[model samples]
Target chain A: MTTSIHTLDTPVAVVDVARMNRNIQRMQQRADSLGVRLRPHVKTTKCAQVVEAQIQAGAQGVTVSTLKEAQAFFTQGVTDILYAVAMAPNKLAHALDLRRAGCALIIVTDSVAGARAIVEFGRAHDERFEVFIEIDSDHHRSGVRSDDPLLGDIAKMIHEGGAVLKGVMTHAGESYKLNTLEALQEIAELERSECVKAAEAIRAAGIPCPEVSVGSTPTALSAVHLEGVTELRAGVYVFFDLVMHNVGVCALDDLALSVLTTVIGHQPDKGWIITDSGWMAMSRDRGTQAQQCDFGYGLVCDSNGTLIDGLLLRSANQEHGVASFEEGMSVDVEKLYPIGTQLRVLPNHACATGAQYPAYEALQPNGEMAHWSRVNGW
Target chain B: MTTSIHTLDTPVAVVDVARMNRNIQRMQQRADSLGVRLRPHVKTTKCAQVVEAQIQAGAQGVTVSTLKEAQAFFTQGVTDILYAVAMAPNKLAHALDLRRAGCALIIVTDSVAGARAIVEFGRAHDERFEVFIEIDSDHHRSGVRSDDPLLGDIAKMIHEGGAVLKGVMTHAGESYKLNTLEALQEIAELERSECVKAAEAIRAAGIPCPEVSVGSTPTALSAVHLEGVTELRAGVYVFFDLVMHNVGVCALDDLALSVLTTVIGHQPDKGWIITDSGWMAMSRDRGTQAQQCDFGYGLVCDSNGTLIDGLLLRSANQEHGVASFEEGMSVDVEKLYPIGTQLRVLPNHACATGAQYPAYEALQPNGEMAHWSRVNGW
Candidate 1:
């Protein structure tokens, strides 16, 4: 049966295949121009098809937030996988299993304790693991400061423990907060200079620091250059969200993922259109709340992906989304969007929202929808 | 091999089986004393094991927020299912299919448009689906007002269309905002009073409205009496959380669900012990942000589930959680919680946090962990 967005079940994740392809090509081309290998983060989609597309578009490898992603992608034939999150000592056995299974899995760490654990585990397993020294470019999350003297100590531990200090990496996650082009450009520059500086210092200590990787969706797209950086890692770019749009990286039309919902009822006096795509489908990620343009849950669009005038999901419960006018327009909401009307809501975050769905209904340009399984959880 | 919390992977969901049983028993007893049937909303845990415990503890049936929940639970041998969300017309076919499959699935609706669609579908399919009219008790979310004329009109449509107008149901969701016992009790009464009023109006309009359902975790626990209410539905009570704690219903110790995470690294100077449980695991609920006490992400507890004084998950990224002191104490983070230390974090909202995990590691009283699969998606 031919299925349009309206024909699909409510609260289903829909991916615009054409827009996704365009996003992939844009990111890949930018990486190519900057003379760096794009190891696209698979955390956003966590789908085999999306990662496959990225690799086909010239991505050198895959960056994963969880070991599950690395295992899932590696099992799907993508050998070079970087486990980007700071490794816990307890997870060493699992990481070793993946490495021993012939997956080129690169583990990252910032603290001396973290490095020692990785080194100790590598020695115990009789395996030489490639380790990346995490750098704090934005101080937004975990990482060692680029110029911190402890970097030498950590580098020495990795090397002495029979492991390779492969490189230095940092994610300019705070770049999502920047709306102005100048601010984004500055953050991008800082991301590059700091990460490269971290790598140079590690090499100066006589430790071989081969790669310097840096990226976040905003920083990667906004960075005019990627000097001295060997690899770039950016997720969410494959499916730009309202957060990215508010950050001035992508336009509303560039959003490739949305939650397909059906209007069940309405609050006539309140001008509200109640939808099945609540926080469970749209996610509780209010990533756009603090941005220049706050999309309450998401920006409402017709089933065809056309932006509906002034409508937005004002609030959400577990399984009910209250869509109303952004400006509190007193127009009859039920008359405008009657019961059973299918609407596609552009989520505030592709990563958070996409995590809520079991699979994505990838809509092709030919008006066909394909189910792409998206792996979730740790 | 037998599993304990210590042996499990980091960032896993854990359910304290003992505490859950206690919670289930308490709610079932409350319903018994109040002269109502306890229909536990399986939407909270979405685990057959958890639902089984509730049923074993004397729950009448199951209340679900999604049709998928009805279908899954029905397959699990739960015949009586109440799909509580306002039904969209397109979902009528799916609901009918489930009904024909020998599942006593009751669909709820509020508007005339919703009632008419259900009627037309019922007449066409030759299936008389049981319908519940949603009542707006506290004006929190979806429901027809108790005094509204449309309630009678919708009731007329359901009865005349050859479908049974089963009853009226309302969720005092706003009761979660109340910290005072008096406020909670009043809201509970209002929920019961308003729902009863709607039921009476329906009966007066020549329709037999047999059931009167009303509940919220807080209201269900605090209501002095559920007078004129035949049934109660509460989900999160099965696995209480910080939001429930702040509402004065469940104590902090009653939070059965917690995210089992391992400390991966530390930002010593900043007094931060980073864990693998971030927004992806803890979820971006922040439900406690406006509450009396804000437990950022969650309340941190030791591996044994003992509350760690002053420690809380301060902020979270996609894959990392920065656990710091609630009072911003300049304590030695590394010494307090070294790398690889497993901690169980009590979530702000149980429903939101539990949705992130694929399964729960149910902690038995004898200190063993059992893997309980949790179904997700609509």
Candidate 2:
């Protein structure tokens, strides 16, 4: 007997399982065609079942943004984990603990101070830590410029200071801002070439640097070739969102994650239908606002996961969302959607929206349902 | 013996217990002077310890935004609970269950359909649910206007249909948009008079209205008197944030919640000091963006909680924050905040930031520390 999603609580996270599996298979196929290993970033879902599904689809290892994610996935028996964010000195002991627990945990460093701290911690703990030097291809966030002299210095520090210099990795996060395939491909190539150059720079310094990693959801889907990159990493493609759709990467129906909310009341004068899901359920992610179309918190959908064009969740309080037409008055809102009317909202960013819920109610193609719990706080 | 906050994991929520207690006492005292019961909204910090502290400081009851919060706090012995959001029909069973369990759970409704659902559900289940008629004082979100004809109909529907019409409640949520004391006072008065007017209308319809409730953090602290209001409700005051600071309701030092983060690297060329606390940690609130002084994501502070002027967390990725001066170049960025330099970030909105964490590392003024866990998902 399959449980029905209609009977579950409102303001709950709902994942279309068949769509999620299709997304997983597509990313794996893309990586395979590009001649690179796929290391899916688990930060988006952080669910063991989702990660297992990716692994089953031929994804090797995993990328995490937090030590807690690393620890959680490691406890679930997926040993190959890469802590992708630049390593902080304070987290060295936690990394050491994970490494000692027989997990192949690889850490990243980008600055001289970071490399020194990792090396010092490794020496003090009598452990050789595997390290990757983060490369700045897009100048989006953390990382060292590929051609900067500090690149060689940081690489040498990790190599000479009793740590294994695994290689270089870069994420073209700025690719999310681009809507055209040409721009995405350009950023993807820059990401690949810059990261490969950094690896070569370290090799020229007499250190055997293996592995070149590069990707972001946009770049991964748009890259013409992987070339020197040994592996590709991407998050959010596991459950596409409105931002991805606006960026021209995914179709609207491909959005696998949505918040299932129930209309609680209405303001006929204002043409507003209030829903139980607000910023607390949808998350305060306005990622699509900068795109061509601004879906004010999210795009509204009918109860059966079909898009209801022209309506948007225009505003939100902690527990109340106001849904209305994008342009004019939504006449007959009360009669159209009365109290207890269930609706779905596609998020602007899956990673942010998925973080709000403790577990997602996965709806299978055959109408079966399953609960998938995710990692919460660090 | 006490543990230093520095020893805790990076990106952990830190609550100043002394400041929180003072905030609680101040609100309770204000309610006492106003001749009203204080029903502190527990949505900002869903921690039982914080609620217990508020109750000890003379708060009469607690207000929650979600039923899960109601359930969690009810399990902790909080009997008089108000689920503040407008009631959805699908949740009637859960509300009935809570009422049957000897808990004084008060639900809210603002429309005829909402009232009809509650009345029908109560009659079907052989339960007489206590309910509040929600009044829209500021047109901020959900509620019926005091002069709206629907207000009387909704109240009559609940009272005449085998359910208890407890009273009327309203929230002056737009008070947060005002920075001047005069405007805040004006909104506060409007909140009180409108809610009381709605209650009087209900009484005119032969229903015995016993209570009138109103408040918001800015309005609660700025109101000279809350006449005709039986209780005041305000969230985000217990752990005042940057938005409240800009709203002129709380001093910066009165902010009790902060995210403790560590400098992982730096972009010296861009004068960016990278920290581990990103949007995922501090939340994508940006509540102060439209305020007088826009704190990008948040205001930067020293590890000891001293505000570092001119610096703001300008941008954030999923797991990396870029902190820099608001205007000119921040020379010696690496020297000023080297790798591993711990810093605290005051959040833009306490309710949003607190929702991102599972537990808070509460620090006592006497150097003692405790872990306070909070409710996460609905």
Candidate 3:
């Protein structure tokens, strides 16, 4: 844990420790002031060390994207966990195992058929599976419409089928596409209200709905207030990336994650300084492509983590990234960025880029480093 | 190895063993009939088992995109390794260790500065390292132009620096952009002839040019003859993807890898069948976006490996994928693909998609599975 950051290998994922702590504190304060518990989504890092820090910073429970994550965190002694993604019937046994092992794991469903499968599996196993209904707040991705008659119907089905009907949840993923503050705030309000409305319907139908959750990094940061929401869940806010920067949620300096790379070669005439951080290192997520500013692959930075204006990682092959300036081949690249020079690239999306590496080199404020392992796959 | 593939976890990567071996033999026969050695690029799979199979099928040596691959394969007794990407000066120590361990690790360079660094390091270590001068035949990526005056300059520098000058190499990455057989064949010839021309220039300057290596999956498959070339190196052909299919080189059935997933839920009105194979499992590789036919994230298929006529994985979140018809949501998704139903999705790019999984489930001909571990990161 005491290795120097600069001594690490190129293409290593580095997390700025100071920035990460600040991000965690900012979100925890926001949730506390809004009177909602922050159930930070552990899917962002999937590292026990990072989640431990979140829990220490006042996160009540954890939100997971898969059963594997729930199992992983539960092994780390985290009891309360919510698997955010809609449950697949085939994964029922894995969920049951975690619950039986003393982990309060909650699964979700968005359709009547999905609920039926869960109920059938729960009854067959003679286990009371806690379930949540997913609501469509912005019509961005998979979720049931808040007003759908099936929302209450699925709740009643779960209650009558010997399973625990927990609550309703939704993610305002479409809020990412909006640039204006007003639009983001409106979507945030919608995400909170719709999820609350879904919970109310279930309770009115004589079903016990104990929780109502809503989040997305953008919506969580822009929400005016969570009047009826009981808990907030947001991933990627702990390590804000270029996508969040473009959305006006975080400043460029607030980006905690970057890929440390080495300048290998250069195409002088073409003004390209090829680095070892390519798509494999930075990931193939072009999240900033549709924003007001499009960082081709990512924004380029100096070895000291200072943003280099005009210079950008324009294109990438599997193991090579081409760094070029917007003004064209104006400088002597070989002279300016000689071979072996170290550089860091700010990624477009933190979650995608972090998944590319097995372990993260967390650069502490004292210049020391901690190697934190990251889990991958389902 | 005797376990049935159907019993494996959902979202696991499955490599059809029969199809992979057929791909290996097809490429090997092509290279042998053309009077060239086949040096399979292990970067495609990064699996020792897959590379061993290639060598068993007559591949002479291995091509790698990173020193990590060289180290991994070398530890497995594969001494002949080519670190194909332009070597970064900082990796000199690691390369030296590989060489000292009796590995014939060949490094590459495209510029005078890059050559100088290699020479300086070689002399410092008192080792006559073998070096390859990369030639830019297609102007697509890193290399000194085939006709650039620097070709002879770097070659002379490498030869005089107490190092072994191995000769020239190039990758026709632009070949993937072509769709017609004629265009692909023409680019393949150009890739070969231009690389040969670069080697001729080095030799014309009184330097020995023993090898002329050129390849890319599309170029290697389309080249009519490699008259002046000694070796061909191609990755991704062992597991053809939608990108290669759109490039008109591989048939749909030629694809050897797929993500096996289960239908989790559905939005009956939107006709969306949600699956656990999201970007995390399928990878965020939209490589076919600009191709002749765009397959969103991937093409949908039945559990038995037959292509679904109109179904396509239209979009992906972190832990979920939305499958719908290309024309429109015309079918009752809940009935057609009920919850817990198994499905397969062919990826857009084999290399990117394969990088997402921790291990690949090799599906043998008899429907049994062999879990093959895949190497990741530098």
Candidate 4:
């Protein structure tokens, strides 16, 4: 009773169920052995089913980029969630609603104004909230520097304003810029040490800090030590994209999701084969920019899911993709993919491509199909 | 009354009504005097409100890239639609549903299997579908070359089947690759002439050839003459992006939509200001590959929607963006944007970024906000 292309709609997302389970279990086992609580980020899939899988595989908490995700998952019985993004004043009500719904909501902030806004919102709603002062570990993206004087001030404000200080959190976002695993490991250590130091600073300021969170898909997965970190929040591990593979975080086989498309035309003279999948199908995520290897939009695969070596989607439009094989790479396009023949395309960034589609067609080990819905919007 | 940030949720999308209406009228008026049918592609906005505005502005029909989009717009009273992508077997039933609901669908196909599949589906469903044989114009993406010997044969097969032949169509997708407007105009003329030749071949083979549709936002806008193109199907003109401006299609001021975000933190030493807008908010669309100028992720704007000269979002993580100004291009990060201050970011690709959020907060000329939902998923 294997489900084939005839049973599903074109342009629908499909996840290899066995591979997905493996990805979840592998990360959970690593986190468990490292003595750190695993809080797998749900922003990758935005699907309750995927989140449930992670929870069943031993994720103690879930990380979300938006308050909408927190509210949606809270309604679905996921009580512990880390709203990983800086909360805006507009989203305060939604956060309060999640807190009222018995959610162990954790919010991150680095600015004095952000701290004040959250504090004011908590007072107005008369709700006690958990807060973490974000530390900038690598000067890559957001957060106050680990040694910034403002860190202690923000911690004091959060403590005095009736909010529970939940230690500190930081992301080694620059870890993705590393070209070698050694560089990534160095970044991981730096992130852990900085977070511990930031927590120590808050403790010295008379704030009771309980948990220190650190995350980055590359750094978290490859970190050899978790001496100070109490929790790990890494998304994109469950669905490894081209960017992850290029950074040596995961292998090609570890990627659990892909966009299934069909060959629509061919230009043999120009050595171009057209597929129905375009940027809209795979997303405009050029995660290969920093990678050692550039896999155009994504790694092309044959109908049976075998990686088509040297073939890449060289160009794309809104609804059409042009694939070109590397020089001297030869394959019988007409025989392997007669017009209308179906094939799968691995994404450059799973989170972006996966978000473009509405639902996932879960393919079991034996090829049976089970549909799962994904959440979108704010 | 003006809409307050407190009334809207974080991560929700917003559209400027005045700018959008102006964009609609400008394109409509341009196409009207050109004596070509203005068939606005709905893929850019995908909002019913935006589609209604296009229709009210004298757009004769709508263009969509997927069967799901076709069904959505059809249900919304858009009776005429051109499903711009190659129609696959999986989408045939959905296309038939739209036709059964009394919607006129113009689908595109270039191969024999595609033609056969559509014909078979039409016969099985006891319905007739209108189709256009897609022709390659500049080897940009999909479609058979106009000079391909099989072009006439594919047209004959469709004409012999129960489906109605609606001439041929082509898109100069490569027009975006041009470095100058002269190149764009050349590509446009090439696309229009190629499509006309393909339609002529179909008519010579005794098929009814009524319309030769050619489109590409860059080409359509800069084209001096569209003599052979009976109908134009450009979409991105409604919301010009950095890609459009780079390709000489539209100016930066012509971009009608932007991602609204709030400043969260700053690193004074590094001159880095972080915002809530990241790849998730602006989309990971690097439209600068073909453009002469690279705007990093997108053009930065101030709280009042004014473009911040010399400042661009140099880097982004999944949930955080860091803006960098050119050397010596001084700007007040603290005075202009205190923490929690709102700002807007123009996108690199309008269609890709617009698809990230689920709805648009339609802002009236007076700054009053109204909710307009956009359809997503397959």
Q: Which structure among the candidates has the greatest DockQ?
A: 2
lDDT of 2 by residue, A247-347 (tens): 88899989999999999998888889999989999999999888999999999999899998788999888899999986664478899889999999999
DockQ of 2: 0.89
Off by over 4 Å in 3: none
Listing candidates in order, what is each one's chain A TM-score? 0.98, 0.99, 0.98, 0.97
lDDT of 1 by residue, B157-234 (tens): 999988999999999888988899998889988998999999988888778999998888898998898878899999
Judged by DockQ relative to the true structure, which candidate is superior, 2 or 4? 2
Q: Which candidate leads the pack in lDDT?
A: 2
Q: Which docking band does candidate 3 fall into?
A: high
Task: Estimate, for each residue in B18-119, the C-alpha lDDT of model 2 and write its tens digit.
Answer: 999999999998999999999999999999999999999999889998888999999999999999999998888888888888889999999999999999
TM-score, each model?
A: 0.99, 0.99, 0.99, 0.95
State the weakest 10-residue window (summed lDDT) of model 3 chain A: A325-334
Q: Candidate 4 residues A117-170, lDDT tens each?
A: 889889888987899888889977678877889988899888999888887889
Q: Give the TM-score of candidate 3.
A: 0.99
Which stretches in model 1 have alpha-carbon errors above 4 Å?
Answer: none
True-vs-predicted CA distance for residue B252, candidate 4, Å: 2.7
lDDT by residue (tens digit), candidate 3, A136-188:
99988888887988887888888998889888899999988888899999999
Model 1 C-alpha lDDT per residue in residues A9-117, reported as the tens digit of each score = 8889999999999999999998999899999999999999999999899999899989988889989999999999988888888899999899999999898889888
Compared with the true structure, all predictions reach lDDT values of 0.91, 0.92, 0.91, 0.83
Per-candidate clash tally: 0, 0, 0, 0
Residue range B1-378, candidate 4, lDDT tens digits: 477633655444567777788888888877887789999888998888899989999999899977778888888888889988888776777777778779998888888778888888888888778999998898766788888878977887788888888878888877877868778778888998899998887778777889999887877777788786789888988888888888876778778888888777777677777888888888888888557898888888875678878888887777788887898977777666676677778888889888888788777787678877887766
Candidate 2, which segments miss by more than 4 Å at Cα?
Answer: none
RMSD from true fold, candidate 2: 1.1
